[model samples]
Target: MNKKTQLGVPLSAQNRLFVPVLGASGGCGRSTTAGLLACFLAAVGSSVVLDTAPRLTSPWPSWPTEHGAGLASVPPGRPLTRHQAHAAASRSDGPAGKWSVLTDHQDWSHGPLDLPTDPAAWYQLAATGAWQAVVADTCHPVAHDIVAARTKGQRGLTAAWCALPFAVPVLCAPTSGTGVAALQTAVKAITAEGLPLQRMVVVLTATGEGRTPPVVKAAATMLESQVSAVLQMPFDPHIRVHGLSDADRLARQTVAVGSALVSAVLASAHHTWGDPLPPAPVPAVLSRTAVDSRSARPAHHEGVFT
Candidate 1:
């Protein structure tokens, strides 16, 4: 890696969060949801997006070939100076404020590619007050390992998506009955892994879709009884690889989905930290309530990780 010509102080943060988006399969929209959610989180307030998608190049935005350190590139226990941490993260135009990405370093071909990042490192970085949230785009088979590593021995971590394989059997089920059954089976599978069902929120996305099938909605309704929340991704034809576009006009409905996701994330944060989120912009729906219930305090383990 080449030396960054302009390293600077990290942005001051009022609080921090870590949201890992995981799915059972590749096309489950985990990365897309994560990227967009990260952008929305940033637009609403200060945040850092961590791109851990196992791809040749990031599915979100591309960091310049001559770029600074990736968040994953930081060595264990080696604290980053404010400037170094900022250089390690950047936005589309250049290194800037809270709205930035810390992509995987391009050297994983020979290193540990499938491993989840160390939670201690993440904890240390979060402790620095440089970001309000760290949204991670991750996939399964490996996603569980990441969750286990992060959750190991740490109680009440306030992390979301515990064992949410994010399966879409319902999406392919031939009938409404089959779809609901499939979703139930998938939920059972996740619980068998000893993951807290209450911490999980299943998000369903579509392909070339303008509307969700009635069967799928039925499946989601069934899932709502089993999990804390169930969300649907709004189909937007304009979604691009570069990132969630601020330049284009997003539909009112799509904006609502983003708002719900933000509130869910905040609810988890509040549950874990036992404190109100710092001042940040919120959607109209969320301004009234953040989530269905003040997420019951840390059901998995005692004491919060943050």
Candidate 2:
């Protein structure tokens, strides 16, 4: 058995609301989740997406940033705002809602070569005090950032823990036995470190099929005991293909999961940081061409995002 607090324990809020969509690896739909969450939050209020996952990149296009600076181009520890990263952000397409995004850049010399190497730098970025909410897609397990700090010759702080004070880590688990096993492993690892679990949300992303796998169902049920909440995001073929292109249609597809996620996030925000502004609704332009013959059709799989 793992150590955990009663469900109602308070998770100290930081200066911002950071919803980090994290998972076992690159293929677990972390990027898609982060992007969509940002969009949803933008619909309710201003939001930003920090894409630090190692392999995945956001499909949204970049808007013109102030003075043309990328993450790496900005001096480490130098204050940065969402506007500064706008050059690196994907502009919100109409009807999808407007949200700023800071993802890895194209040029090797320009943006960060990898995830934030310095924990302090990560802190600076997180503490920048921008946006009403932030959704970060992390490639590695939440614990990996601690190891990164030592490698950078920095001590005491790791990216994950540094941001924990302000973040509600959404652990995206696939609906597979391997996914369950991975979640179990991660839970155990983080528990051993004694990191608080009260703010964590276990999101089980399932593929579209006849039935949910028995093992995955069992795993999701089991996970309910270890974290704040467990959410299921059914597979949507549109997100699998378009990756959050049409927000209006996607919202309709993922209403249940989206509403649930927003509620959980707002509750978490209230607990952690006190009276954060609510997410604003951004009207989305609907597209007729988004749907095709595929069974998955057009959808948001909202839990992966919202």
Candidate 3:
């Protein structure tokens, strides 16, 4: 048998939460948020873990040099097969019941690339036994195969077999109306399955802490209607210290900001809506349509050209 924990709750029961750190676009602190959340969970003896995926937006370093841990990037593009993903998850090391991290490469632009399809081996591996709380940092166009597996896998199966690992879409809080319109479009795609908008959490970034513009407030208000939760975090000063030499400072900074986000997640996990919900089942109207309209919306950078 694999190393067992004291609770013996089994991997699935133990890993009640599956967090996918997503942002409206890249460079909006999605990766940093994932890394820091892992550290915070570990510090609190929660057996935390963070898994990354193959994405074109951000570069994956060999190790989490900044935080002084084992936050490594997985191989990107086509090479990330199902067999490879399962093997990596099985091989990782962590406290018996604390946490585990894994990553896969499934390009989003191509359309749903199922885990059972890529290598077809993971479907079985996940059923057997594996890590708890698998946090996958997904690629853009969020509705991909890997994400589908993590969110809405076949029910009545083992955690490895079933999907629905608490999917959180990280949205960059835009300052302009145009940005908000684009976000609305993405929300529609995420909630299309009717899997409970609560499964989605929007992480708002780039407001630079302390000062939030009116457009930012409006955007958050609009998204709150579409998902379970909305969180706000400014461009943390700590991320500026990249590279191994700045590890200490970076780790400290990550821990500080990451902890707050984690608390919100834990709190939101058990509760219903704290604020008025956003418009459910957003109509098929997104920023593309907004562009045609002459609304004085905020201007935000759209990540990923495709």
Candidate 4:
């Protein structure tokens, strides 16, 4: 494979690639997949994981971060500067690489966070950050979102992300009969809406250690010709016990699964947009003395937030 292909580089510096990992249903390892995807992508270029899950439910705020104001600090309606966007994100480093996470930071004692419901607003905020890749951990059920968007004339967040240019969606499901059924339904709905089914990657995640379920194996066989690729992610005990707080503790096989998923995403983008993906231009901010002082240091030397 070409180095560029392996890295999942964007086709243009101006065109940011958005990878939304949408689950067929809840408890489908959506957040785990998103975090790992961002980790691997960060190895090649600037990347961030946007926690699109609702307030109070997102796991990002609990994860360790270098520095950030949290997503709640983002001002509404005003244009977001790259500095502002970067500041609102909590940065973290691990074995895979460095990546930032933007998620709700409000405490339960406070009133509910007023997160933007308009999908365009979220996209704009991410684009303004100038991140090369964005891994969105979408919370809603995607098949239902597609139906709602089509029938009610309302734009669903997952649908909007999938429709964006340079999008490579990862649809996840558990390796169980019910999970496979939900995934099948989601694929059908995505296809019916005239979306890019060819660019979709289906991930069947194991919730616990066991042999591959017959239903999951059958689903993979049937979906092989439909989507971009079908991958099985083995269960990681660390994630089950401690959640995604520490990437370094993730099992090696789990990390390998993430690498495969990233490769599939890059291949999908290449097929959809035709590559050698153009190299991203250096950000003007890097030319400034202050930005250079902060960003020019070696990755390992950067200070970590306790």
Query: Highest lDDT: which candidate?
Result: 4
lDDT of each: 0.49, 0.55, 0.41, 0.77
Model 2: per-residue lDDT, tens digit, 1-306? 111121122222223466867675435666666766666565454577765644234443332122133344433323333344444445554233566666555553444354564333443353443355667665555545444544575442323443544667777778777777877776765675555566777777765645788998888787777777888777877666666655555645465676566567667667665664333222121122322221222222110010
TM-score of each: 0.62, 0.69, 0.53, 0.85
Candidate 1 accuracy as lDDT: 0.49
Model 4 Cα RMSD, 1 decimal: 7.6
lDDT string, candidate 4, 1-306, tens digits = 543445554345565667989899878999888988888887566789988777678877887457589877776543346777888899877665778999877777877666766555566667668787888888889888889888888766777888765789999999998999899998998888887888999899999998998878988999999999999999999989877788877899988888898888888887887776544333222223333355432221121110
| Candidate 1 vs. true structure, TM-score | 0.62
Question: In what order do the candidates fall by TM-score, top score first?
Answer: 4, 2, 1, 3
lDDT of 1 by residue, 169-252 (tens): 111122234444544554554565555556556677665555677877877777677665777776666654333534134456
lDDT of 4: 0.77
Q: How many backbone clashes does candidate 3 have?
A: 17
TM value for model 4: 0.85
Q: Which is the winner by lDDT between candidate 2 and candidate 3?
A: 2
Candidate 4: residue pairs that collide: none
